[model samples]
Target: MKLKCLVIDDDPMICDLVKHFCSKLEEIEYCLSANTGNDGLQVLSQQKFDVLLLDYHLPDMTGQSILEIRSQNIPVIMITSEKDFAALAFDYDEIVDFLVKPLHFDRFKKAINRVHHGDSNSKSILQDDNDICYIKDGNKYVKVNYNDIHFLRSEENYVAFVLHDKTILSLIPLKNVEALLPSHFKRVHRSFIVNLNKVEKTTLEEITIGSRQIPISQKYKKEFFEILNNKLL
Candidate 1:
């Protein structure tokens, strides 16, 4: 699904940079722009957008003023040169994330992704007793059920999800994939993530699921055992 995005920034260079960053993402389409908060509000009133890339400081008015006067429905990622506004950004329910200037591409993508999911922090998008997630397969995206997944193993730039019948690979990093997974999934090692509910047994050094064993590295062993112990009791 493509998101309609509006940019509100006074700097022409920042506007161009935003457009350049968004042009590369399949999820967001650059829809509109405004140089000031009042202009932004006028554009907002005339059209609709799924997300807003708002600059904190505007010539006529601040981004906060616009949010206060408008509907809190749209997800906003506030971009600011000043780090002091981070605490203030969260006061508005519409603001999903606060990004400082000189935005990293990966960080920008993650912010856009959060907006794509409607800022959902649910365990997973469950349907018909199945938990599902999307994986990019070439140009097409595929839906994979969490129940079918046995474990996730990191492979250089990619992470592979081993299933009972088939394995699914994604180009996303292990850390990013971990954030997408539900609470029932645990990262017991830097290179391994396992479904806690699928575990048949657990040892200090490894976790056994079905007939396969997944190694638990020392990096995460302490925290892993703490969570597992609580679940056991």
Candidate 2:
């Protein structure tokens, strides 16, 4: 399958160079470019990419800074002139490889091949290799880990990812997001889907995870209890 890639660099010439290098490999069918971190985030929110070719610095934000706030499951190849950040960049599991600027085709090709083969060290086995989904947050996509999601609550046209610290709002409906989740998530209420693994305490009416309690609707309570009971030790 052809991989969709994005190149985010402040230099327009570097963007073109990445596109040119991608063309040498038939595996890349689509490539997009952005000149700044904010613009890159916007582009990523709009499309799904398999590989990201990113520079270390930009006018709006540094590449490492962006990765620190939002985690993208897409394999990232850091191409920068600086060698100082290699140790720090490797801390992010999504980072596939770090290459010094003035990129060589052989090194670039290796990064693309790793993405094509789904060889990122951060690959998640519970869901897709990229076990994270980008939630549309205003003009940008906030990457939230699937495992970090304790539960989902429906709010009319929006859905909220209830995590340990904050609740992230997304435009997607509960059912739509529910469809994307794996078997570990179950709809115990029309407005709530709880990650069964995150559930710490349970009762007939509510499920407690961490410090929060999520309600279970009477409509689905019977079936929900049946499933939860089956897994009881």
Candidate 3:
């Protein structure tokens, strides 16, 4: 099926350029175009899209704000001239890719291809019963099983997935890892991701996983309770 896409940019020329580039790809169908973030939100409410080409700066709202309000399943590629904002974009795991201003057609195509391939692999992994996810570590991809994981601690740029008997540090950012993990895993704290299947119990402020007791941040209290309630029910 052709991947439906939405281009949300205030500039008419940039919008046209993106549309023209996407037209060459046989698998991409430019489904909608909006000149403002509000317009984009309206379009999102009315239709379903597989990918979103979003402008970072919008008259009404930032692309990041729009993304937070939109569905998580729709992959977003930020279109911005500010290269320094790339790190900020990574914080939002739903952003699959970033495109700098005056984007090269080849580079744009490659970015879209990566998002497409990632989505395909994620779908396949979801169908499998095995509780292992393969992530890129430096130059190689390593498979880490759920049973092997004891807990996850987030560092500045990476997450340390401490295993039962070993530890594997992944170069991929923590937010990205959190987004990819199954629902069984819970983010109890800002810097910690815990697999609920591995959790032993929970107190008012902390959760026990084996011998370690991880703190549950107030920001995630609602989600933590939801998980606990679901498990109990």
Candidate 4:
């Protein structure tokens, strides 16, 4: 699919740089620009863009404000010099990638690739091995043992990885997360993926983890029960 991009930044050079980068990629149809948040909002209302390359600090308002006010579900790639905002950017479901400025062509390409990676066919970009997976949380990559993951819940564009003690939110779809997970993990419902090894009990409608009972949807019930039944001694 051809991508229509919007670059919203006060800096003319940054806008030009993004346009130039977009030009290099054949998938991008055109890269449009807006200098202020108000102008950007106006442009957004008139036309639908595939992805947004937004500057955190605009002349009129911050990128966070735009995210709150915008009605569309357009995926955003935040561009900023501040590292601290990394934590905040992931809080919004619209944000897919965060790029710290002094943006290199390679990193820019990576962010654009993330926008494209929303498709089911795109290869998983997460780092994983036999024992563990590196999950991107804010500015840091958290190493999580595969056995430690109890379940994963889909939160629109984000997935919440439920560990024993805490939950880590990563800017990725559950399907993508599923691809990185080990064999023990299974999709028990539309929004939930459970680690079969961590399951303590199961009923006709739900699978029990520690304290949570996740639903077993009709679509996945037969396959899930077949796997569970096979383990019965």
Alpha-carbon lDDT, every model = 0.75, 0.76, 0.74, 0.82
lDDT by residue (tens digit), candidate 4, 137-213: 76666767888989999999888999999999878788876765667899989899999999999999998899999
Pairs of residues at least 3 apart in sequence or in different chains that clash in candidate 4: none
Candidate 2 clash pair list: none
Candidate 3, residues 1-233: lDDT per residue as tens digits? 67888999999988888888889988786656899998898888888998899999999999888988875368888898875565456556576667778777875775677566764322111111236454445444455677677778888867788777766776655676675566677888889999888888888799888778899999998889987898799
What does the lDDT come to for candidate 1? 0.75
How do the residues 35-138 of candidate 1 rate in per-residue lDDT, one tens digit apiece?
Answer: 98888888888888999999988899888888888653698888888755554556566777656787767667767888888644311221111264545544
Candidate 4: minimum summed lDDT over ten consecutive residues — where? 120-129
- Cα misplacement distance, residue 18 of candidate 1 (Å): 0.7
Off by over 4 Å in 2: 70-72, 120-233
In candidate 2, position 165 carries an lDDT of 85
Task: Name the 10 consecutive residues with the lowest summed lDDT in model 1.
Answer: 121-130
Q: What is the lDDT of residue 186 in candidate 3?
A: 80
Please list the residue runs of candidate 1 whose C-alpha ends up more than 4 Å from where it truly belongs after superposition. 122-177, 180-186, 189-233
